[model samples]
Target: MLMPHPKDMRTLLSRYATARLAHAERQTLKSATQLDDVSYTLCVATATTEINDALAAADRILAQPPPAASSRP
Candidate 1:
């Protein structure tokens, strides 16, 4: 798949983080058993790491200038 622009990726990552937090909140409300709590915790941990990775990648991409186009036809 084609890579997304860093600015766009950052926006999308923010949305993803919001959605994940909402899901975690819903999961928390429904968690009545130990297994359910464990599952919710794992889900939250995974989401946190993935979101952090995406944010870091976007930051790295934004820190550099875009590559120059080749002059040759």
Candidate 2:
């Protein structure tokens, strides 16, 4: 399985957080739509079917240390 880069995952997480809060506060169709979009993107990126599972997966990924830098002569 392929993994997303930490930076990309972070961006996705940010989008999810924003969308989640926006929908929670306003409860408008627009906010709901945005939340759905972000939720799907988050699921796809994390390779999980459920939002809760995807969130846990994301947390696991974020908790990991970044890859060591490569040195080339």
Q: Considering only N, C-alpha and C atoms within 3 Å, which residue pairs clash in candidate 2?
A: none
Stretches > 4 Å off in candidate 1: 28-53, 66-73
Model 2 lDDT, residue 10, Cα: 93
Candidate 1 to truth, TM: 0.40
The digit string of per-residue lDDT tens for model 2 on 1-73 reads 6777778889999999999899989999999999999889889989999999989999998998886666211
Q: What is the model-wide C-alpha lDDT for candidate 2?
A: 0.88
- Which stretches in model 2 have alpha-carbon errors above 4 Å? 69-73
Per-residue lDDT, model 2, residue 19, is 93
Candidate 1, residues 49-73, lDDT tens digits: the string is 3535545655666676754555222
Candidate 1, overall lDDT?
A: 0.50
Q: Lowest-lDDT window of 10 residues in candidate 1?
A: 40-49
lDDT of 1 at 39: 38
Candidate 2 structure, TM-score to reference: 0.87
TM-score of each: 0.40, 0.87
